[model samples]
Target: MRTRGALSASGASVLLLALLVLVPIVVLLAAWQQEQWATWQHLLDTVLWRLVGNTLFLMVGVTAGVLLLGVSLAWCVATLEFPGRRWLQWALLLPMAMPAYVLAFVMVDLLDYAGPIQTFLRQWLPVLPDFSARHPLWVVITLSLVLYPYVYMLARLAFEAQGRAVLEQARILGDTASSAFFRVALPMARPGIAAGLALALMETLADFGAVSIFNFDTFTTAIYKSWYGLFNLQAAAQLASLLLLFVVVALWLERRGRSRARYSEIGGRQTLRSRPRLAWGVTLFAFAVLFLAFLLPVSRLLYWVIDNGLMQVDARFLNLIWRTFLLGTMAAVLVLTLAGWLAWVKRHQPSPSVSVAVRLATLGYALPGSVLAVGIMISFSAVESWLADLGVGIVLVSTLAALLLAYVVRFMAVGFGPVENALQQVRPSLVEAARTLGASSAEVGRRVYVPMMLPGLLTALLLVGIDVMKEMPATLLLRPFGWDTLAVRIYELTAEGEWQRAAAPALTLVLLGLIPVMVLTRRRSARLS
Candidate 1:
């Protein structure tokens, strides 16, 4: 047990953190009784069902597409041996660096009537009609290509981590290779696949840019339209609350489905490399997936860079690079500082209320960025009003401080999870030993915990930095004039159908995003080996 004083300090910390996190959510919810219900009923009678239907359809389609693409590719990469398999294992994850909205832009542009493909077709076969890119299903295909790598990375790591004897036992029972895979390997990897699906689904639900580009009115787009178009913040808040309910339900279903079985046969001698090979067709299938998933978007950007050449790299471009870097760095430092401190507080003093508060604080990552932006706008507007009554001038929106605060709220969980896990893995005996030697809490953290936690701390920083660089919706709304980062620039250019201009920033974002994924997988591969 900790000292009474320490316990009191921790309880206070929990209340403070939870209050900060919950105020925005509570404010959004309070819009219900304060606003008129005439518009709410009108929304239900008019476009709400259409929005719900479109959103649900996209979710189902994207989930199926990612599972098919991600799981099949993961199985092939883990089980089959062939040419280029070594490189493909990591290279397949490259699509994760390509944001779904960017991929949507590339796909729509290339398939349009005047693009290269249709132009070549007209030159050759002139009788055929123009390519049509209007169907909403294209959104599903585009999102899946970029997002499948979430499932691919997690499922591959999970498949590689399990012992091989489980499969061999299935073989001894006269099970076919396919049977063994379906009945044995798949179930064993359910936990990891479920986790990956949850992440992909969360992104799918939170998606605003891609759906907007494609003219598909999902709930996120509706939220923005309600606030920005109708100027009805109340309607937007209600839409956001409904969207959040959808996310919570989806997460619960995934968890319950995955809770059916427990995995205990974890470590054994036989491994993914040592497993028997299937046909070489699996390699061809994987190659085709890589072409569609990664190569298409990248090749389009490469052509842009090649054509524009040095003309694209000017003072304005350099400023974007600098501002993006500065924003990412600041956001990373803030998330790490708050997340590390909160996690350390929990480690030193564990109580049920504090644990629940920490969990609530982490839920921001699940809410859509547009929803968060609306909540933030409402909360800040109230503060500004109060300050005005106090005879003081204050501007929070369109300020760097507000933008960074939203980033921390949206992404702190990315930093906190690794910190908590790293701290948990340290032997409690080590801490107790340090305490017995009359070390203060800070001294014990420095002498005992810091060395072991440096890697995780660095990982949290890099991940949060990459996420901040790629973050779009909140930055789109909150950034002050002249504060356009790379992602904001990409969204702006892509929105205007200027793919050539967007290509430069989009590619830069991709390169930066790839660094963290590469580092993370390398660490995982080392651990599994």
Candidate 2:
């Protein structure tokens, strides 16, 4: 009777959650009901095609850049031995600690005409050509530098999991090392590499901060312009729906690319291959990437903080940190709870309906935050109006509840991935034993599952918390009045071109982001070892 009751309750929750997720998508689609033909015509005449062209261009450039950087770095770290190879394996991930926007503004600060780089260059070479910091290529490079780890981390695992045996077999068949890598190892790692590529592309599509800094127009930027610049929510929704189409197409292509391939890992401790000249060259290349991506940007941020005293942590700074921490904690707990419940239900029920609902529920992670923000606000406005009509007088739009809901929708997959992996490690036999011993469902969960899932739960919390802290687009659009976070603060300061003043919040975000990067590095290290 309890088992049936639990199943019914879980199914209800899953269905409700799935519906809640679908609300935003539905609202975004229904936004066309209120026709804004003038706005559509203006967008089409002026900037619509430009947005599409720039977005596709950015995607193509980032795709090539990340593939080159991620795959080569992953290959070098996973299969080759070189000077500083062990340290570089994890050090390469440090770029993930810097938000692409932070790097974007920093690059502009240092390299733009008014900044130090050009100032110094002009002193020696008076006729230096003026270079635009707002170039679209810079946007692609900035995003690729920060986003490449998504590809590298996964690709490294794929290569490492293949072990030395497969490569050795290929070499013994008279294949050169380069030929063996291209033909044998690369093809086998295609699924993982593709998965990583998809993630990187999704992030690129969803990015608002980086592109905004570069002044490069894309769908994300267009959505923002429509909502804030033009004050048209429906227009924003229209643009968001278009961006959603891009995301769907990217996901479909990624899925189709890997659908027919099957990969089996030959698991063994990979013996690192050492080639002296190639090893040193790889070391040089890796160092250059790490320096440009992580070290240089970080040094500049630190310099801005110290050289410019406006960033001194005062009462306002503390309040910003406190609010950011509070929001991150709240969102982390809420997302983890939902994710854990969903994972548990899937474990117990394992039905097709539940699986489909869970997938739909987590699909929000692929969506741009601007898309989610517009959809959610539109949905909330309807709810607020309905409540007002019923005399409840409760408000939802621009409230903390709305913001948290956006966070949950945007980050459910982030929390779910860790919790699901942890839950999968819990033995079914152990669960059955608990059931046979007369433990109630609640008791079994508390006594058996809680202890086992603690590590993953903590991991989920940390990940979700950090992601919430760094998130810009949703927070910018959905935050309540006077509830500005570090991310929002950075965006505001950067928008005003106040790079020096923004250093405090940007530095704080980077430091906080490092916690998760360190966690990932440690986990990856353990696996490789």
Candidate 3:
């Protein structure tokens, strides 16, 4: 009787946490049907189609570019022997530390009319008239540079896991290196590649900074414009609904592809694959690719930081850095805790209703920051009204609570993935052994599951921490009045054309992001080797 009570209490606690996490989404959907449908219909008639087209085009373009750059680079680093292959393997991931908006700012600073590239061109050519072109292509290129690392990391892991025996067998069967790679290696790496591609697509869809600055109208930007520009929350919600549908489709495709994938080599004499020698011509091509993809944008940021004397080693700036660190760390811990609990339930006690509910809860990740902000506003407003009706005074909107909830909603997936992946790796027999030894399910989970899943939980925390630190649109909208995160500060400065001031915080966020990437890479390398 006591055990049953305890189990019931535990289940209730889990359910309550899940409900709190879902409150804003529930409020948003309820409020949308209450008063905003008409304005949404109007906006849908006017600007919705254009926004949809631009967003779809950008998503497709960025997805293709990231996959190409990421997979090719992974292939080169993993399978081809080169002079700096070892360094390149890790260095390639550095771009991910740099946010898309920061890269966009760097590109604009370098390629604008009065910027370095044009000035250099004028100095050399001296005769070409001042040429100006609104190149959307540059946005695609800059975004790819920063985002391809997602694909690269996954694909490289896939390649590294592909043992030499399979490739050697193919070679012995009269297959040349190129043919072997095409027929055997690439097919085997599909799962990892697809996973990477799914991540890339998600980032591309959720992007606000890069698309906003580049003046390329995507669904995210449209959501922002509708909410802030026209004060049309309903319209924004409608657009968000559409965007959500698109994301659902993409995710479905990715899941389908993943289900069909049979990339894991289950039984084989595993040996490290020998690196293929690069011909001189191919080596030069590889260098050029690396230079254009990874080196140039980074070099630009370094130059601007040095040339403008923007590197601040001051106390006030240090305080901002500390605050940013605290916020990110706390948010990561909170998100991980909630995500771990939810994942645990999904894995152990999943039913159709629970699975559907979990999926619906995670949809917050796909909603635009502006849409989420509006949802939060609607929810908080209702709460405040309820408090007033009960003769109690409470302010809910524009508080730390609201901001944290938004962060949780936006980044739960980051924390969830690592924990789930970690849990999957632990053999089910370990838990079964504990159960057979007279341990309850709760005890088995607490003892056998949590300990083994700590690394994955930590990884998830790191991923969410980095994402929250770099997050802008959501932070900008939902942050308490006068409370500025590093991302918010950077975006404000850059928007005002104060690139020098922006560079400091931008650099700080990048450095913070790099720490986790370095840790993850080291741990991954150690395990693989």
Candidate 4:
């Protein structure tokens, strides 16, 4: 009877989660099917192919740039001890604290002809031509700087964690260092490298802020324009469906790459890998990458804030910060609650249906925020329609509730992944023992599992909070009237080329972003220690 009760509870919880997760996808499909054929034809005739081409171009460019920079820097720092190498180990990650949009604005202003860099350059060399930041090259460069840290972090960890014994064995078999690295170390690290690239590619695909700021059109921007510009939700829904196809393909590639790469952990008590002596060539190269990636953009932000002074942080600014913080907190709390429930269900009762639901729920991480927002609006509009049909005037459309719901759908994966991992780590023996002591499933969770999952729960909260705080496209697409966040403020101000005014909010976002970076750093430190 007790087992049956547990199963019943698990089934109920899993079913609810599955429905909630399915809402957006189902709504998108329904919206697409119900739309006039003219809408799809209009998209096909005009912007669909262009959006696909631009998205693919940016994805390929950014992926290539990130891989080159991330892997090289990872190899350099992991193997060659250089000046400031220890500090570079952590400082390389600072750029991760800045959103791609923030980086976009910084790069645009600093590299502009009227800006200091060009102003000074023209003074010495009158032959230099003025360059526009809107160029596709600049967009790729700006995004690569902020996004490369994702790759760098993962590749560094992978490179450091590799089996040093294998490399040495290859070398002893008359292989050169370079040859051993190419044949042995690189293949073993492919899984981590692939995972990092997958993350970067997803971020690139979902990027509306950077692309919009730079006037680069992609599927994300197209989806937004379809909904707002053309005022056609059906067109938006169809575009989002197309975006999902891109995500599915990327995920399949990532999975295939990972499956083809494997490493065995056969040996125990592995010795620490020694770093080679610092060479000036390597030292300068590391510093150059660090200075370009971290010091330049951050230094520019700090400078503008100081130069702009107190006017930037007036009553309006404080309100923006407060609203942003409150929204992020509420969303994070709600997501954590939903994540905890789903994680518990997956842990307590593993079934095929539950597994599929879990996959569907977490898959949004690969989706662009604009796609998610469009799908969310479709679902929300349906609920509003149903409510009106039932003779009630209350509607979620254009309400704070709608925006928060969108955040939950889009960012639940950000919170859930960590919590699910924590849940997976909890010993089944411990849960079984607790049940043997006459504890109900609920009590067992509260008394035994909750405490154990606290670390991941906290981590999830921080991650979701930071992501919500940084999120732009979804918030822009779904926010209620008069609802403005720091992210939105930054987007608007930066769009108008108001870099000085945007600096304060940008700085705050970066600071709020540091919470996750600090968490990552502390965790890495703990592991190393």
Candidate 5:
């Protein structure tokens, strides 16, 4: 009877989570059926192919670049002893703090005709043409720099987990260092690398700010243009739907990759692998990666912030910062709470239906912010119209309510992943013992689970907070008129060619993003060491 009651309680909690997570998706799907079939048909006939191609190109480019740079850096830090190995391990993750869009701004500032890099080159060479006009490849390079850390962290974890025994065995078997890395270490780390690449690709597809500012024609940017630029929500939704299809493919690939590349821990104590000392050429190469990827963009932002006097910072800027903080904090709290619930359900219930619902809820993370913003608009419009007809006065569009909802939708997975991971590590017997002690399900959760999961919950909060602060399209579309967040302010300033004015907000976002990365990296390092 007690066992049955525990199971019943678990089922109920799972059901509650399923309902909360499914609501927005059902609303969005219903709204799509109601309005978007025709527009989707039109897109199929017109620009769909081009949008697909552009999105694919960017995805492929970004994924490949991130994998190469991220894996290399991880390998160097994990297996090779170097001068700055300790610092570089943590420093590699710093780029994640800088959003792709802000990096886009910095890249444009440095590479554009009027930027200092070009100015210096013109003075020296005099034959160098404008870089931006002459080369669009820089956009891809810039984006990869900011986004590669996703892959780096994952690959590093994989490498660390593999320990030194496997690699040493490969070496003893007469394999060269390069051969061992390629044949053994790389293959062993494939799952982690794939996970990271999937994240990077999802981020690439969802990117609107960077691609838009670079004058790129990816689906996300195009979706925004269709909606706000042309006043055609249906057309935008259609583009978004196409983007959603691509995201589905990426998610499927990630799932398949993980399933096939499973790694098992060997039952033995492990030691940290000593790294080979970097030769002169290799040292230069590592320095170059750090210089271009981290130093350049950060220096530009710092320069702008310092060059622009404090007097130039206005009341509006301060207000935006405060607003960003409040909204981001609120959204983070909500996301982490819901994520904890979902994670608990997944861990305790272990039913097919519950698992499917949790996975579906996380699908929102893959949807482009513009696409999700459009979905929110359509769904909110329908709700408001229905409420108005019922003589109720409720408006969700252009309000903080809509913004928070969108943030939750887009970033819930960020919180969910860490909490789910943490929860999985908790022994099932611990929960059973709590229940056997005559505690109710809720009580067990409060006492046993919540206390144990605090670190993960905090990690989730930090991840979601940083993501919300740097979030762009959803905030742009959903924010109330006369209300602004730091991200929006930065976008506006950068859009107007006022890069210096955008520096403060951009710096704040980078600083916030760095905190979580530092915490996670330190934790991982401690575990490995």
Candidate 6:
């Protein structure tokens, strides 16, 4: 009976989480019930088509750029013998530490006509044409540079897993190295590559910061403008609903691609041999990517910090750091608790409905932070109104409760992956022994599972904490008065073209983000070893 009670509790928790995820989505969809014909007409008459076109164009450009950069680099790092193969492989991932918007502002600062690069160029070549940093092409390039690591990491794994044995077979069948890659390796790695591409594209679709920094308009930006600029919540909701459609499609493609790729991984780590000259060339290529994507932008940020001195790190700055850390901590704990409960319930109950519920709960990660911020606010405001009509008064909107809900919705999946994997690692015999010893499900969890899952739990905590700190759109929109985080600070500064002032917060976020990247690399290295 005790075990059944524990199971019931866990199941109830899962249902509640599922409901939380559904509320925002349902609210966004139901927003159509209110007719804002004027706003709709203005959007349609002016910027709707342009938004669609620019969005599609950015997606296409980013797709091409990431594929080329991600696939080629993955191929080199995974298959080739290089001078710094080991270090280059890891260094390539450092770009992931820099958010697209951070890179956006840095690039715009450095490469703008008035910035250092063009200024230096004009001194030598007087005929140099004026280049605009806000060009759509530059926006794509900036995003690609930061986002390609998603593809590189996944594609490299796919290649490293199956490249050696298959490539040898292709060689024996009279295939040249180039032809073998095209014919044998590329096809086999397609599903993984597709999965990674889907992720990059989803991020591209959801991006608000980079596009906004570049003065580029997409659905996310449109949604923001509608809400804060136009003062039309209905218009924002309608835009969010449309953006959610794109996210759903991207999510479906990722899952479908993963399903097909399930059997593609075959184990081997042997690398292809390369000549000394070619190896150095590969080293140079990898270094160039690392330099441009990470090193250059970071160097520029550091320069700004040094040039500006300690002016930015005053009392207000300390408070920003404190609030950011506190919020991250609160959100991390909440997400970890819920993720643990979901994992435990899945382990014990194991039903199709439970699986679906878990899926729904985690889907929040794919929804743009902007979409979630708007949807959640609308949902809670409606709840407050309904309660008021019942002679009950309460406030949720603009509260820490609302902000934390957005954080949970956005990051539950980040914590769940680690915790679920940890649960699976627990030996089945140990679980059965606990049952034989007459422990209830709750006791077994507290005694056996929690202790064993500590490492995964810690990992989840760090990951979710860092992610929440880096999160901008939700926190920016939902934060209560004086609740500015590092992300929000950077966004505010960059919005007003204060790139130098924004450097300190952007650098702080980059440093914090590195914690997860280092953790991931170390974990991957340990697995390989």
- The TM-score between candidate 1 and the true structure equals 0.93
For each candidate, give its TM-score against the true structure: 0.93, 0.96, 0.85, 0.92, 0.89, 0.95
lDDT of 5 by residue, 1-529 (tens): 3376776676676566555445544554554555656666766797777777777778778877888899988887766666666677787787877788888888888877887877888889948753563244766787788888888888887887787888788999999989999999898888998888888888888888887777777888778878888788766765676677788888887888788786855443355555455544445666777778767777888888888864566787778888888888999999888888887667755778778778767767877788778877887887899999999999788888888888887887899988988897679899888888899989987898788888888888888988898899889888998778888888888878888888888887877778888878777767756
Residue 25 accuracy (lDDT) in model 4: 77
**Residue 95 displacement (Å), model 5:** 0.6
Off by over 4 Å in 4: 34-46, 266-278, 428-451
Between candidates 1 and 2, the one scoring higher on TM-score is 2
Summarize candidate 6's per-residue lDDT along 1-529 as a digit string, tens digits.
3487776677777888998889889999999999989988999999999998998898789999999999999999888888988888998999989989999999899888799989999999969985887889999999899999989998999898884777888899999989999998988888889888987988898788999999999999999899899988888999999988888777777777668554454567775767677888888888988998999988988999999995657899899999999999999999999998898788878778788899999878888899999999898888999999999999889999999999999899999999999889899899899999999989988999889988789899999999899888889889998899998999999999999999999998999899989998998899989
| Residue 280 of model 1, lDDT score | 65
lDDT of each: 0.83, 0.90, 0.75, 0.82, 0.79, 0.89
- The per-prediction tally of clashing pairs is 0, 0, 0, 0, 3, 0
Residue 81, model 5: lDDT of 68
Indicate which candidate wins on TM-score. Answer: 2
Candidate 4 CA-lDDT value:
0.82
Candidates ranked, most accurate by lDDT first: 2, 6, 1, 4, 5, 3
Clashing pairs in 2: none
lDDT of candidate 4 over 1-529, digit per residue (tens): 3397787777777677667667777777777557468877887798778888888889789988899888888877765656677777887888788899988888788888788888888899969875775889988887888888888888887777764677778999999988988888788778888888888888888888888888898888888787888898888887788888878777887898799776654252245455455456766876777677667877888898899784555788888889999999999999999888888777767788888887777766776778768877877777789999999888787788888877887887899989888888789899899999999989987998888888888899999999999999989998888789999998899879898888889888988999888897887778677
- lDDT string for model 3 (1-529, tens) is 2365554555665566556546655655565565666675776787768887777777778888888888888887776666666666777777778888887877777777888778888889958674542367777787787788878888887887786677888999999988998999888888888878777777778778877666778888887877778887666666666676667766876787689788666243254344455544445655665666546766766666787775446776776677677778889999988887777777766566557656655656655566567677667877899999999999998888888888888887778778878988778788778878999978977888778887888788888998888888777777777668788877777778777767777777877888778878887778866
Candidate closest to the true structure, highest lDDT = 2
Q: Which stretches of candidate 1 lie over 4 Å from their true place?
A: 41-46, 123-130, 266-279, 431-444
Give residue 297's lDDT in candidate 1 (0 to 100).
Answer: 83
How do the residues 377-424 of candidate 1 rate in per-residue lDDT, one tens digit apiece? 888888999999999999976688888878888997899988888878
Which residue pairs show collisions in model 4?
Answer: none
| Clashing pairs for predicted structure model 6, backbone only | none
**Model 2 residue 20 lDDT score:** 64
Tens digits of per-residue lDDT, candidate 2, 1-529, equal 3487788889889978887679898899998888899999998899999999998998899999999999999999988899998789899999888999999999888878788888888899969885787878888889999999988988988888899999999999999989999999999888888888898999999899989988888999888888899999999998898898889877986897699778868875567888887988999999999998999988888888999885478988899999999999999999999998899888878788899999988888888899999999999888889989998998789999999999999999999999999999889899899999999989988999899988789889999999999999999999999999998889999999999899989999999999988887787567655
- In model 5, which range of ten residues has the least summed lDDT? 266-275
